[model samples]
Target: MMDANVSDQRLRHQHQGLWLVAGIAGVLLLAAASIAIGAEDLSPGQAWDAVTAFDPADNRHLLVRHLRIPRALAALLVGAALGAAGVVMQALTRNPLADPGLLGVNAGAAAGIAIAIAFFGQAEAGAYVWFGLGGAALSGLAVYLLGGVRQGMNPVRVVLAGSALTVMFLALTHMVTINSEAEVFDQFRHWTVGSLEGRGFAALGAVALPIGAGLLIVAGLARRLDAVALGDDLARSLGSHPGRTWALAAFAVILLAGAATAAAGPITFLGLTAPHAARAIVGTAHRRLLPGAMLLSAGTMIVADMAGRMVARPGEVGVGIMIALIGGPFFIALVRGRRLGHS
Candidate 1:
């Protein structure tokens, strides 16, 4: 019996490892495409030469070195951040539809960034990440209080509270932007629409720590979440603290979402869709699910960003718009499928 169990565990790891490899491969391929295909297309050889073989005179080399690489990294990091956050949130709520946005985390982060720009004139990402994290924490706390933890945490009430808060925070963001200087509006507008136009390594570096910390927290919470998903009573009986799990998971989500929003604004649907797709590949186990979703989302974001460049040509569509165009249909289909399944 012991030998059989060990064999089963090994097999599971091997299977999950394969999916992880596939995810990595997909992201790498798309990232390469992201660097190579753009406003001015560059061959893979040229892309490499741009890095290895220097030519300051070549505009393509400068574009590759300065623009494409940074944008791709930003998209990849933000996508992975949101994807990981989404997985943690869905597990906590036991609701497949639960995303960081459903809890107003993204809106709060955006509001924070807007406030920073409007009030403090701090427009850099370093300031954005901090203000964003602060805003997210406040919004999450509001939801927690309104969510009725004293009576036991109800996922439905929490979601509703989040929905209400999201509206309020979004309005607050707009009010600040509208009331501020026209320059603020111009800057905020670009970010709000979610573009990757001129972001560089500085932007990525600003959010990396928070995002990394969030990923670490999510990883620690995965097994505990597995226990919690079985129900609070069952989780406690198994020696997991469901309350602690919720607190930590919520913190992790806020961290991830805030940092991502700080980097690329409030991107929707990637979070909601990535987990479901990962589940199909890795089943319900979060250890596999988190990485799978992260890779899938990272690849998807790179693809959406590249496609945005292609569709608009001289003028490009925002990555946010491209994502919505893809994810909106997927969301509709998911809802329809759920309804049909229930019926």
Candidate 2:
């Protein structure tokens, strides 16, 4: 019995270490690929030279420095933010299907971008950050309030409230785009599809602090989240305030998911799939799950972005569409396979 227990512990530790290593390696590989491979292919040597010795005279070097670097970095940070938000959201809602988009964060951000384009004449995504944040915050608040912010909230009600709000916001976004000018509609349409094409360091910088702060807050609340994963009464008995913990986690989710969506135009399925994949690899422990999901999501985003670059050659598919193509099926499989009502 003792030997069996010892062996199991050793295997668990080995698995944990392997997962961490694999996650790191996957992220590094994807990052390299994202930077190296684009519309214009360059040799490994050229890519390295571009990174090491940037020269304005060299188009390859300029592409790497001015475009790929920022894009790759944006994908990484945005993926991380969304992954962390997903983990917290699932924990808070006690629903496996719960993602950042469940509370209309994506729609809210889209609506904000539409408003910015139509009303404020803001053409750039970086300029939409503030409006997106405001919209996300307000929409999230609306969902929470409508879902019963009072004590002993029901997860089902929250989900229903979010679904309704998502529809409403999406409708509003559609109406705004339809009535807006052709130029504004074109820009908004592309932005809503979610692409890393034109995004740069400035776009990433706009949301970096918020995402970072949200990650820190979520990290601190991991244990509490675990407690909340149990029944609310049990969590309270274990000295975790379920309501407070959920509220904090929800706020963090808004910050992280909102920033990611605002920065990159709502990359879906990453938040939904990343946490579940992390749970499969690292088990339910948020300590490992959070970072694991972050790495996985970052890699997934990079892969999707790379695929978008390759599939159409010069034309390129949007990362959002690529993810939808991948995630829509995964979502269906999950629904068909799992019992999501009582996660």
Clash number for each model: 0, 0
Prediction RMSDs, each to the true structure? 3.0, 1.9
Per-residue alpha-carbon lDDT of model 1 for 1-343, expressed as tens digits? Answer: 9999999989988988998998898898899789999877888999999889979999999998888988888889889998999888888888877788877888888898898888888876656667877888789888878988777777889899999999999999989998999999887887788777777777777788888999999998888988987788998999998878888888888778878887787788999888887776787787888899999888888988999999988778888889999889977877766541121
Off by over 4 Å in 1: 1-13, 122-129, 148-152, 335-343
TM-scores for all candidates: the values are 0.90, 0.94
- Which one wins on TM-score? 2
Error of 1 at 110 (Å): 1.9
Q: Can you list the residue pairs that collide in candidate 2? A: none
Candidate 2 residue-wise lDDT, 1-343, digit = tens = 9999999988996898798898898898789878889899887889899988888899989899888988999899888999999898888888787799888888888898899999999887678877888888888888888888884667888889889998999999999999988999999888888898888777778888889999999999989988998879899999998888878887898899988999888887889888887776787888888898899888888888999999999889999899889878976877677655532
Measured by lDDT, the strongest candidate is 2
- How far residue 335's Cα lies from its native spot in candidate 2, in Å, is 5.5
